[model samples]
Target: MHIEKNILDNVNIWLTPTFDEKTQTEIKEMMTSSPKELEESFYKNLEFGTGGMRGVMGVGTNRINKYTLGKNTQGISDYMKTAFPGEELKVVIAYDCRHNSDTLAKVVADVFSANGIKVYLFSELRPTPELSFALKYLNCHAGIVLTASHNPPEYNGYKVYWQDGGQLVPPQDGEIIQVIEALTYDQINFKANENLIEYIDAKIDEAFVKSTIENASFDTPAEAKDNLNIVYTSLHGTSIKSIPDVLSKAGYSNVNIVPEQAIPDGNFPTVKSPNPEEPEALTMALALAEKLNADIVVGTDPDADRLGVAVRDNDGKMVLLNGNQTMVLMTAFLLEQWKKAGKITGTEFIGSTIVSTPMMLELASAYGIECKVGLTGFKWIAKMIKDFPNQKFIGGGEESFGFMVGDAVRDKDAVGATLLICEIAAQAKANGSSLYKELQNLYVDHGFYKEYLISLTKKGIEGANEIKQMMIDLREKPLKEINGQRVIMVEDYDNSTARNLFTDEIEELKIPKSNVLIYYLEDGTKICARPSGTEPKIKFYFSVNEPLDSIENAKEVENNLDQKIKNIIAEMQLQ
Candidate 1:
């Protein structure tokens, strides 16, 4: 294998004394024995995208190691000083169960504290959402969480949050990247300011639990809660720290935790992946639900920002709901609650992503509120809350199993969302219906909608180029028809414009520029193609819907919609 000069230069820099001895040895060993791996490790500097960075843990510039994280923290510290001049700077730090997350977190804290920033470090592993909450609660300038939510065991990540408890977005993210890019690894200050670091545990945890319970609980009767047998799993992540307590304090007593997955372990030994979005990840929880005859089964991803839920269908069989289904159910419930409280004063809005189901628009229309759609990540959804001060953000969710109940956290919160889902399930049950039945009713009232996601993973440099080319091809030669449905309008988010195919009229998109494209068919189907900002994959989202005349035919309508999605996939050759 031939290595580029720049890559070799990067590798040689790591072999120098500026880096630690162990990292140097690993570099030399890779050079002699594994040139391909060595080339892959240093092909390019790991990108710090809009929301921090995540990659496999290794001894290279392109990996998540002590040095990479140290460089990032040092740069962020420098930028913070300029962004907030002369104000006493403070930040909160939290880590997940990933290997070396604690040590890496300490490294980050060391850099921040060295720069005279006060640091509140979690004494134990905590969920990513709590980090968001803790930052705002402590009145800090910024926050950092060391977690790779739902990624493989070999991966780790660092996500940067602003003072508003949301991930970095737009001009701030771009500016920070510029500052970080101008520096070398040797510029990192690893010296610790011992007095500037404080370990926090009980007080913040108590406050976060209280806030979660208060925001998510909506006066469900105690009998309804007791009758709803619930099975919960953390999937070897950090949700166990807060969810159980939140549920207990919210007056839900009958909860069973999956014994095999209850303990926090980064290895995620119980399942193929710790992602609750995958059915396999919830296998153990599903089994426990069956054994307990539970009414609902809930599981959160490793960092607990996203949750996957399973509810009893009309046939008395447990069925797992996808991210979109969960989001629709949750968002609609929140809107109804707000309406009941007479809080919907026409200034409230719900948030979702462009790639999410358009059914969200239907729900928003039904409730007489605006459903503001942004790019693919929850950071954009969080930005919606910050961008609109006067408009009340009732709640929002993405198609990726993440939901934020209110503005308290400013990020996707599984703890609060879990409590909210349980409330919905319990109330539905008390009203002579189940969660699944309520879904069917929703479909009948609105329209039967089905969504499916196709994600293709390509690894290494070659894979990166391949994914880029795939997007380019999609843009250069746009699809005119999908499954014989005429393409009425095309939304190219990269250019921030939508073109009406029938009229050839171009209109500006108010959302920010992103590498995403959506096609609207004449028959009301929506297809969106977007490359993953955090992972080595490209995702295609298909949403197909039809009018359901009655609840009796909901299942058949859903099956037809599912088939429509499959047909579109086959037509696009995405299989």
Candidate 2:
């Protein structure tokens, strides 16, 4: 329950800070509230790791506040000067509707401006993808978005992007971390230089809308504009302002919005979690879809960077599509369209996370092109594109519903996804096909693939230790089978190697070391386990596949796959 010593003491001398009355009052309140809570809040500064700084909003070193934001900005500014000295460095900044998000964004802008960097700041709320596009559109050196994606209302974060407009990667990520950890709290200049910061608004949005639609457009129109019924919800976040407009511009006249969930409320009034991946989160949207008798329903997370979708099946029952299904659906639609246009001259390559549905790889192979798999983050996908400058990257996505469809931006793009999903729906309807039918078509041709994701949460001080212990236990004792099939191989991403139990062989994985474990079964089952870097939880991904026959039995086969997955997890005792 105490501070982890020697772990971060090398920077202890920089802990003492100077702050104003509001910040002082908050800290004093925390100090008076159970000495244990104070240590938990101030024992260490919020981390600037691969995903940038994310934590609960509070007034301490371990919390996310103006001071922490300023320090992070100052460190980024310092690193920028070294990375590009004597150059006019500019950073595009955007924020979500999270508590004090705009205030923290302004703190970031002030720190950058004080460091003599140019700032392209949003005058109002916008999706995180727009921030990524702004970096490329404005030709800024990097970008930052103040959001924690779908995390709880109490959490906020700072996501750093590179010149590529994606999250920072590789040597740069490590270099920035080093720069951030070395800064003295007193050295960060929080003074505003308003003259250097420009407030940006809808003008940028106009450009984003055009680029998003143009990229998602097809050669010819599908059916009548009102033929498709679509329902959408922003989940009480930032997308409400733009999604309707985007769909209208894309020629979808029957788009219906979930009235109650349209507003940008940080409390997320209706749902336990704002994440669209949860069925509960999509309850309101689905109800509206059912009432409107819509063809498709969709929702986005708080920042609108991640997306979720659902559609009606042949049985007339509505079901939500997981991240993998969404990606596979989108990829199949896009690739088929582009191939018909002859846009891909065999030089194009697409990318997705290794944890994403393997269905994409099969889909890509069917088209006779390359499908590269990156680590579980889109930063790695962007890195792959950057590493191969000559290869054309049509789209890339992760299993978390974060997708970047065009080369114009490096981050996951909800705008592009919005238009793409609508287009896919239109294409299906025009071809007398449903999204479910198209998915089954792919399954029938390339074999059926099913995937599942499970997350285990650990809370408070004991949670971290418990997660660590779980990882230790898994590594020490490997499972021989998952639901009857013999174990084929185990890929321990932590050590960056895959071990084949049959041959007693070990092969190197291309990516760097990360604390992840994967257990593969001979029957095409995959289970991936990793502790969350920011939150107090561990996530496990399960994937299993089988053959697909006639569409009539697709439902039964799907239920079978679901039960098989459950049995596998039960054998593993994750239940």
Q: What C-alpha lDDT values do all the predictions have?
A: 0.92, 0.83
Give all candidate RMSDs, comma-separated.
0.9, 2.1
Superposition error at 13 for model 2 (Å):
8.1
What ranges in model 1 sit over 4 Å off? none
Question: What is candidate 2's lDDT per residue for 526-561, written digit by digit as tens?
Answer: 788888776888988888888887777787888989
lDDT, model 1, position 489: 94
TM-score of each: 0.99, 0.96
- 302-415, model 1: which lDDT tens digit per residue? 898999999998899999999999999999899899999999988899999998988899999999989998888889989989999989998999999999998999889999
Model 1 local distance difference test score: 0.92
Candidate 2 lDDT at 180 equals 79
